[model samples]
Target chain A: MKKKHIYIYSPSSAVRDKAAYRRGIQRLQALGHEVEVDEAALSTYQRFAGDDRTRVAALSRAAASRADVALISRGGYGLTRILDAIPCKAIAKAIERGTEFVGLSDFTALQCALFAKTGAVSWSGPALGEDFGAEDGPDEIMEACFDDLLQGQGEGTGWRVPPREAEMLAGFRGLHGATLWGGNLCVLTSLLGTPYFPAVDKGVLFLEDVNEHPYRIERMLDQLRHAGVLARQKAVLLGHFTGTRKLPHDRGFDMRTVADRLRGLIKAPVLTGLPFGHVPTKVLLPVGAKVEVAADGRDVFMVWGHRHAPGHRAH
Target chain B: MKKKHIYIYSPSSAVRDKAAYRRGIQRLQALGHEVEVDEAALSTYQRFAGDDRTRVAALSRAAASRADVALISRGGYGLTRILDAIPCKAIAKAIERGTEFVGLSDFTALQCALFAKTGAVSWSGPALGEDFGAEDGPDEIMEACFDDLLQGQGEGTGWRVPPREAEMLAGFRGLHGATLWGGNLCVLTSLLGTPYFPAVDKGVLFLEDVNEHPYRIERMLDQLRHAGVLARQKAVLLGHFTGTRKLPHDRGFDMRTVADRLRGLIKAPVLTGLPFGHVPTKVLLPVGAKVEVAADGRDVFMVWGHRHAPGHRAH
Candidate 1:
């Protein structure tokens, strides 16, 4: 395997699995890859201490500049705060120089922003949070993501879901040409009017959320529909929105309800129960990658990463 | 107190509070008024299902033909789905006849639509969810809402949230005149590209949310900002976004952060921690009610509406 230089940047929450972060750094070192940990990025104090912004901005720039890969420490609650403040142009230019970015959850804001502002396709995968030093995450997910992005391997496949009888309805057309965009649904919706989320038309939008009720999910979906987002998309792919606390009076508006709502509004195919998002066995997808959605009648297949040669960068 | 007929209409979920709906019915009945329940107006199984759109249209026509009070049951999630289905012309004619309209939350969509389609100032306050229940709601809230609409019994008070602390920054000037609109932040955002949420260039926009985390709140606020909704508002009044479940990282971006984010984006004064929205002790406001926003540094007062007379309707 090629030696990859990964720079870790997280300038928000300092205490979000400190041990795991150190352990990951050790693991990367043991693997003989060059891993740079910018400790300055871990300066966030009690959420939005004014200090975190400057540090986050600086670390974002530094991580993007010299590293072959930029690894966000964890998905914490501080990216959006520093989004406008961060030097997006500098980060974009770094991507132009070729640097792979990776993170999910709160990191989604940064990933989306990188794509929107810089046209850099960033991956949403394991961060230093629950995935690191944990057996919960499938080893295949980690290997597939690293091989595809770092090793510049061909299209990484294997998109599967546990047994479910909900058949894909009439809308699943196996065509995906648009940029793969989205992260946490709630966070993505939050980016509605900001410069972070550029015009998302004809994009295969993917989203996931955790610990929200079905009604709340319905509300967020309603917001997206009202915003004319769902109608504009070519396909709506839902990640596993787990830990959904259903209200007593909630009438079947589960993940299925969300899918139905999207199906009702959009002409595009709406597919739910994807293995990505906040689920344990999550797959990785780049926010800005041009990909294809191959859906047979039974299950949808995500052909992540375009056909890139070992030495070529799409950007 | 004179006897007056009370009609209850909801977008969806508000009908479940049997106590509130029943009390509202009984309150009017005990006062020797004909208490009427618009079962079609109540938010039910399918929201607008069995809503009897034709009858609703006819009722609006009859009431508008005679200038009657038409109270909406509750607010949840159905109005927009029934927009084209609802008899717009009849509702508009009724508003023209000075028929009073009321409701909030999901009902905000309907109320905003009524205002856009017509010119009636719809009232937003205690709904059939709590108004007609066995347990009495705040008397002041009920009196202020119905009294103002029925008999011009109270001032069309603009609206305001008490300051969070003694030391707080205030921006934007005093004494402004624009449209008063908005409801559940998620719901209003949903109305973005649709005909429901018209261009309120310099309006005093009101917003609220329920059960969403801080990041979710920030994301929704971000969406509003991105959609040009936040930047255009003259001033923003935030209501109670209560009991948001704790996210993995509860950053400082609660309601205060939401207000701050709005403040950062727009030159308008952003007020937070209002006793409205999903909270119990909320004040009623009239959407499309042209009112004044007054701020004397220490005190911010929104005073509008006229008070009801003694002989008008049962009080």
Candidate 2:
């Protein structure tokens, strides 16, 4: 793969683990990529990467970096606070120039807002510290996917549904031309009534989250359903919902129940096990891109094609 | 005070503490009120009082009970799932007949939906197990507030703002004829883009929550702000945002900061220390009712007046 220039910035929580962040930058260099770090990328104030203005300025720098890709340091909580001030036009222009914006979690705020404001696509993938700098070394699959994104050779990704749910998702086969839109469920749900929420009709919405209880997940999905979001979707994809603490009082209630209940509520086909979330073996997904979905028994695949070619302008 | 009929129903989480639930009924009975418990009030299906249809039936029975006030067994998580099937007309008719619906947390969904669908008022106050059945005994303030509701004498409620914030809130005085709405921050936020969210312009929005970190609180408030809800409000009254687990990374980003940052974001007066939320000394406030706000030094009073007389139809 050809070497790529990666721009790193912090638009969310502060970098509490500087060593891990440093390791991530080193790992990117080891992979033969030129990395540029934003001046305020390591800045801190309270629980944020910096105050709102600093983070917004950091985002502005990322958009104007002219690098091949702009990646987030980590995802915690900040982007939503700076949504109003995000340079959406510059971001969309950067995407137009083939600079793919990549991050997840809090970055969902930026992805959705950019799409809502300018209809530009962004990547929902790894963060620097959390993904590339994992203590056990970066997972091979994730690194390969990131490389594929850089090389523009990735057409799509696929995963096998859990055995029990395989048959339940058989009907989710063969969907084409549906706009793909969604990211961290909590962040996406927070944009519900705000102008930042994307207005994509019949989109293939995929969602994942970390450290959220099943009940809260169900509540957020119910909110989307109540807001008529789910009804307008062609299909609903569930990625990994990780790091939840279940209480004894929850009894048999969990993510499975939440998904089952959601399936019963909405008419769209709901499929699970997308292998994209806060897990090590995750795949890169394109937010606000048109895609085709297919399933062979339990193996589900979403093909966004090689839409990253310069001036392609899939949107 | 004249004896009033109190209908107890389980529209949300199941009664996990049977003893506490029983004590609540006993306390209400001992207080000289005719207490009627819905047949499915104690029924359980996983974490809910019953399954969706069962809970919906329980809500129907509560609305039909014609009791002076209908109270919830407890709040955990349930109501959002059944929002579509909730009997809005029946609830409105019940309120028209002087049956005031009451509860908090999950019940906020129903309150907002009721107001949006039929312009009916519900009470944002105590639940049976947590409030009336406390091991130490029901809080006198909560009991008095409940009594005030039962007797049609709760014209208003007041509390003293924190001393440091007193001067910051002097301008919050004299807000007249604004709708008093909002309950359980998380639940209320989940209804944002949904039809369930009330369209109350120039309202006084009061919010409270439990187990949410200050970041989550700020994110939710920012959502309301971005959605234009806060700007349209006459004022924002923040009750106790309780049960947070602060991390070392917070570094002083707490509720005070959340309030201060919010005050800077919008023009409406943002006042804190309303005696409500998941606390022992919570005061009842009528959701969807018109209210007047006044401040004297550090004290804030929200006056809803007694608008429950027959055929009054304040809406």
Candidate 3:
């Protein structure tokens, strides 16, 4: 095990708190690791990382070049605006040199594209402006990710997911393991048909989203179902689908209806209400790990391990 | 002009309401046209048109074979599920016989697919469920759409749209006379890189969506922006993007900011807050009609037709 450096990036235009972003840097620094902050990469406007494409692009390239790991400053809106401006080839070349990129929410597009173009392993985890920036989430979760990156430590299992009513099984069959993929549902859906969305066949699919109504959420699930993404997965794991409310005059449609529609449409075993998304408590999910989503009694557990490595499969 | 027969068809799951499905039948009948409710074509399930490949495929083929003008029952989801199951060649053969089709919302998938696969003159417009079954829109709108379909009655000159203090663009140049094509933003984005989205290199793109938070809405816009869909347009016409406080925690995103984003991203002239979507007062916008977006006057006016078509462009 060796020390790893993580780079941070942003793709959304929603205004972020400066103090919060700094706190994330401090938290990571306290864990006895080298930390770097390039102000040039921070968003200047309410939602943009920065309007200056050169600064955004240069910081993106520099972060990749300098780090063993790359993280997003935050997720909102703006990456699609600056992605072409960023040096994709150089970023890809840097990943080949061993830097892993990660973050979630609006940053999903960038992670997907990075994986698509460079095959770099990307995780949908805490961003400085989003997750770690907040006062919530246990310090242990952050430590968990950090330890996993370096030393590959704290790799335990039998993780408990909530609602416990999630389904599984369509293209999914007896005991197959592959890398976990996907991020915020809204962001992942945006990359539909784009070169970014990797093939999900025989892969475990994970999704989460914030502030989408039941019908809109249902429609997105419909989009994935119709596109054959949901049906092709070996198993479906859902995180948070927040902000669903029933309108007074609009009782005909709601989030539960959406959940039901998804259950009906997708033959794959679908699970709901996983503790992730725009919530306080979050789980550190490694995207490119050999993880097992096995059924244990009435509950299902997602376990990860390093093959043939010491302390592997501790769960 | 003689009234034309419009058949209702939705293969795969029926995402629309049965009442609306029935209402569409009644509306066309009330307008003095031959309307038939084929029970076999109707989906028994509330949310789904049908289940299983065999049933959906049979229903789709039979409906396509019998219909003159197929007014899609509604577009909530399902077409793509049974797309490969249906006989594309037969549908193409039916389109060759000059059978027209129209629907918007989730229906965009079917419309785009049929058009791409068979060259059908499919359109994005009022769905049978939300538009017709509910007895809820302005009488004028219903009259306008029906007349346009039945008699080819053109709409009147530059109609005034209601004003909102949205993100206004300075130096908004006037653009007149461009073909209109597009519907829900979510639907259109889904059609990206798909066969259904027409090449509108210099055409006006009309868009609307319901129940999407500002962030999600912005992301869809970003998808269109990054894909260069917006830059290719001659002018951008925004329809109603309804904001609802369904969830207690849901703070609606500003549509004005959306307009501002479009202004910043699109080189083409962009306008906002048109009355068209899940609203009481909706404008019947022909998905493929020539219209004028004039910014030279005190307000933004969308003028379509030869100036006497009973249609007034919303300002």
Candidate 4:
């Protein structure tokens, strides 16, 4: 694959680990990709990467750079502050020029805003310091999957979970051409009732989060279900949910119990074991792309682009 | 005040402190109010006061009982799960028959749902175990405020904050007849984009929470602001926000900073020092009531029902 120009910028929280960020940039360069760092990428203003104006300006500049990809430096808690001021048109124009913007966690605000405002797709996988800058380097699966996505060679991706759970996904066997949407659950729920909320119809919605307890997760899923967002979806995919600490009040309920309750409440099939979210070995997924999803025994496949025609059926 | 029958029930979390709950009921009985406890109020069902069906049955029975006041036994995390099964019409009919449903915290979901579905007014105040059953007994201020509201004598309630913050509320001096709405901030945000969200125009929206850090609080406030709820409000009243642990990453930006930032973003005056929420010394507030509010120097007053004209202004 040809070397791609990767533009790195910070649109969320302040980066406290300058050395790790530097190491991430070096790793990208070593991988034969040209890197361009935004002026405010390393600047700190309070708890943010920069003040609202600086973050907005940095995002606008990165959007107009037209690089092969715009990768976020890190995720924290800042993007929602400057979401209204983001230059959505410029980002859409950048997408038109083949620039793929990518990040997860707090970046979900930006990606959802872009999709809501312009119907443009963004990547929901990996980050600079969080993924690529790992002490032992990026996880092999993440690195290979990201590279394949960037080179436009990954027509489809598949993952296998424990065979015991195969029956849970059997209901989604022939689903096809469902628009895959959603990111961090908390971020997505934050945008509800706002203009920045995406109104995807009959889509395959995927969600994952970190550090949130099972009750909190159930509350968010309840919110989406109450909002009629889940009822309109063709399928609901569950990814990784890590870093949750069990509270004494939780009784016997956990993430699995939350997932089971959600499956019982919503019309769409809820299937687990998606290789995505705040984990090291995450899959790179297109946020607003139309994709075909099918579950066969313990294996699930999600394919986009030329791999399958729109609404293609699987026997 | 004449003797009024008060029906106590649990529509959310199970009663972990059985003695405390019993003590609360005894206290109400000692106050000369006829107290009737629901059959399932003490029954436990895995973190809930009872199963979903049991909770819904209790709520429906409470509403149909036509008791003068339907007070929730406690607040935890069950109401949201049974919102659809709630008999809003029966609850509204009970209200018409002089029943006043009351509770806070998780009860916000039930209150908001009732208001949205039937325009029914509920109480945003104390609960059994948390307030009346306190080790030292019910707080004097809470008992007094609740008595005033229950006897129809609380046409107006007044409270004082630090004189230094009086100027912050000065903008609301001329505002009158603003529909007083809102409960727990998280619960209110959870109902966003749902049919159960009350559309109160030009209202006085109040919010309070417990255990949420400033950033989370700010995000929810931002969601409301972005959804156009704040801009349309006559004033935004803030109650207690306590029990949040300061993390090393806060960098000195706390709840005060969040309130300050919010004050600058929306057009409505953001006033603090409301005697409500999870705190012990709180005033009983009439949810969905149209009230006249004004800031008089260091003192703030809220008056409802026959005490003021629709657009009464403060001199």
Candidate 5:
């Protein structure tokens, strides 16, 4: 395993679980990686990691760090409101110089905005605390994927669709050179009308959310469809939509119902069962990369080629 | 009160409470309004009042009924998905002929789309079951507002801002002839980037929601702000945002903080305490009407003038 430089910062909520954060940093250090934490990583203002100005400055510091990876401490309720103040160009410059900007949930706002403004790529992957600092330690698969990223060995990712969905996958001709974009559904949908929302037509859009009811999920998808977004996509990928509360009034409606309904509405094939979202056993996905996706039986493969090489610089 | 014809239909979710539906009808009859229920009002398909086609036809029937008003049976998780299939032009035509189409929550989608497509006005008000059919009887203020709509005497509506917010309301110079719009914040935000979203400039945007946390509410408002929607508005009126769950992790963040932050962000005044939303005390406000708004101490008044007159409709 290659030892790498990792810069950890908080651009979202305040760290409510300090123990988890500490464990995460310790875990990364144990893996022989040099981890640097931002000065304002633990700062709090209201429910945010810091005030808008503070968070913006923290981002600037991360971009300037020039580390192997710039990872979020955690994602919560921030970023969306301070989008205009974000330093997208500097972050894009950092990415161009090989800094792998990475995070999920609220981080989707920054990723989508940077892509929209500067066509910069970021990673929709684990947060330090939640994924790495879990009481039982990080999932082995997640760690392996992270290691692949650190070693510059990640070329693609694959997962199997449910048995009942295999037939639908068999009919999919797959897509080539499509932009792989999207992270948290709620965050992405929140950017729909904003300039921050990326325009990636013929792209493969993957989405996941937590705690949102099936109706709200369907509503967000409908918003995408109504905005002519779904029609322009080559395919729509579904990650794990976890923590959805099932109500008796929902009758038979669930994520499956939402997916099935989406399939019926758009020309794009709606593929489900992606290994990602607010779950621990998640895969790292390139947010702004052009990728090829193909399916054989129920197994789906997405390839983006080698993005970085080992011993990628910086002091 | 002048007896008026009322056309009741279900264009969104299915009526889960049959007893409430019966009571609502009976209540309307007792009020001397001749209530004519659409044949498919009680029909159910999954969680919807009916399937998309069925609901669309129901909307058509309501439009063609030529009744004094068209009221929804209830509101639930529907409408946003069926925007494209809705009979907007027909409903707009009905509005021109003085059939005041009215509903809220999920109905915000139809109201917004109609205004966007044809500059037609609808009502951001109560549904039959939830408002008129309460077990303890209807709220007097709500019933009075409905009577005013029926008698074509509704000139405007007013409410007193919370004392903590009174000074801020006092500073408001108010708006003149600004387009009055917005309803059900989530539904309104859902239409943000779509063609169905109204392009109302210098509009008095009134927003409300139920079951959304303060963070979520602020996020939606942020989306509106980021999309340049809030900057385009003359003033922002916040109606009742109820049913928000209290989370200990919120750390003092709530609707009050959300409103305060909004007031600081936008040049327009963020006025709260509008008598509307999922609550029983809601007042009917014309969705797309040109109106004047003025603040007097704690009391804020909005005037849309007389939209309809009594004893002049079809049988």
Candidate 6:
């Protein structure tokens, strides 16, 4: 594979760990990839990576730089503040030039905004500091999956969930051309009723979150469900929800119970255990990509791009 | 004043404190009001006041009961689940018969749905168990305010906030007939993009919440602002936000800082210290009511209903 240029920048909240950011850049270079760090990546303005102007300028610069991939340095709580000011057309132009804009969590806002404003697809996967710069190094699965995606070899990803989820997915077998979308639940929910929200019809929406309890998750899903967003989807994928603390008030209602309630409410199939979100071993997914999904017993496979061959089957 | 017929029911989460429910009923009765408890009020199904069918039935019955006041027993996580099954027309008819549906927190969903579906005004105030049946008895301010509202005497409520907030409110002076809407921030945000969200134009939106930190609060506010809801409001009154624990990651950002950031982003005046929401000494606010507001130094007064007399101006 040709050596790809990766432009690393921070578009959200400030990255507090300077050492991790340095290590991340080093690792990317060591992996035989050309890395360019944004001038504002280390700039701090309050809790943000920089002031709104600085972050916006950095993003605009990255988009115009024409890198093969523009990866976020970290994800926090800043992109939302600068959504209106972001150079969407520039970013879309970058995507037109084959830049796979990638990051998760707060990046969901930017990705969704890009899709809404330009109908361009971006990768919903790892960040530089959080994933590549982990103290123990990136998880093998994540690194391999990312490498394949960057090399244009990873056309699809597969994972096995609990057997019960197979029953859920069975209801939606042979569903074809479903637009695959969604990322961090809270960020996605934040875009609701806003111009930045994408009006994707019959899309397979996958969601994940961190540090939010079942009730909060349920509330966000309820918002989407009530908004008629859920009924228009071919399927709803559930990824990992971590860093939550159980409260005494929950009474027996947990994430599973929440999922059950959602299954009862939404017309679309609700399948769990997708390898995505705030987890180490995750797949690189293309947001806004048309894909086909199938289930075989306890296994679920999602195929997109060139991987959706005529003879391909879920087995 | 005539004895008011007050219907007490649990239409959302179940009330684990049965004793408190009973005490609340006794308090209403002691205040010379006829209290009708819905049969399903005490029924428990998981964390809900009852199953969806039962809760929906109770709400429909309350709306059709034609009581002077329909007060919820408590607020929790259930109303969003049964939003579809709710009888909006029936509730509107009940409001037509002079029933003032009231509650906060999760009740925001039901209240906003009512306003959206039928444009009926409800109360964003106390609940039966949590407010009237408080362990220390109903708060004097809350009790007095409730009395005044039930007797049609509390046409307006006023409170003093920090003098600095007066500058924020100054931008909206002479603003009349701003539809006063909104409740718990999270619940209101949940209604965003949903059919049940009221498209209030140039309204005075008041928001309050519990157990949410500054970042979360700021995120929700950003959503509303980005959605153009905040820009459409004549003023944004912030009520009590309590019960949140400070996280180490917050650095120096706090509720005050969050308010400052919102003031910068929104076009409307952002005033703080409204006497409402998840607090003991709250003022009963008429949700969806058309009202006028004015700021005098450190004092803010909101006047609605027939109390807008020539001589009844803010001091």
Clash count for each candidate, listed in order shown: 34, 0, 32, 1, 1, 2
True contacts kept of each: 0.41, 0.87, 0.16, 0.63, 0.83, 0.69
Q: RMSD for all candidates, in order, please.
A: 4.3, 2.2, 7.2, 4.6, 1.5, 4.5
Candidate 1 i-RMS (Å)?
3.7
DockQ (Cα-based) for each candidate: 0.39, 0.87, 0.19, 0.64, 0.82, 0.62
* CAPRI quality of model 4: medium
DockQ of 3: 0.19
Worst 10 residues of 6 chain B by lDDT: B306-315
Query: Comparing to the true complex, what docking class would candidate 1 get?
Result: acceptable
Docking class of 6: medium
Q: Give the per-residue lDDT of model 2 (tens digit) for A8-82.
A: 999999999998899999999998999999999999999989998899999889988888889999999998998
Candidate 4 stretches with Cα past 4 Å from truth are A162-164, A306-315, B306-315
Off by over 4 Å in 5: A309-315, B309-315
Quote model 2's TM-score. 0.97
lDDT of 6 by residue, B1-315 (tens): 768889888888888988888899999999899999888988888788888899999998898777778999999888888788888888877776667788889999998998898888888889999899898899999988888867767888888878777665555565688899999999999989989899999899999999887788888999998888898998888999998778766667789888988878777778889988789989988788899887777788898865324333221
- Worst lDDT run of 10 residues, candidate 5 chain B, spans B306-315
Docking class for model 3 is incorrect
For residue A45, model 1's alpha carbon misses the true position, in angstroms, by: 2.7
Q: Kindly list the per-residue Cα lDDT of model 3 for residues B107-183, writing each as its tens digit.
A: 66555565556544444566666677776642566557645644545453333433432224335555666766677
Interface RMSD of each: 3.7, 0.6, 5.8, 1.2, 1.0, 1.5
Error in Å for residue A185 of model 6: 1.2
What is candidate 2's CAPRI-style docking category based on DockQ? high
What are the Cα lDDT values of the candidates?
Answer: 0.64, 0.91, 0.61, 0.85, 0.91, 0.86
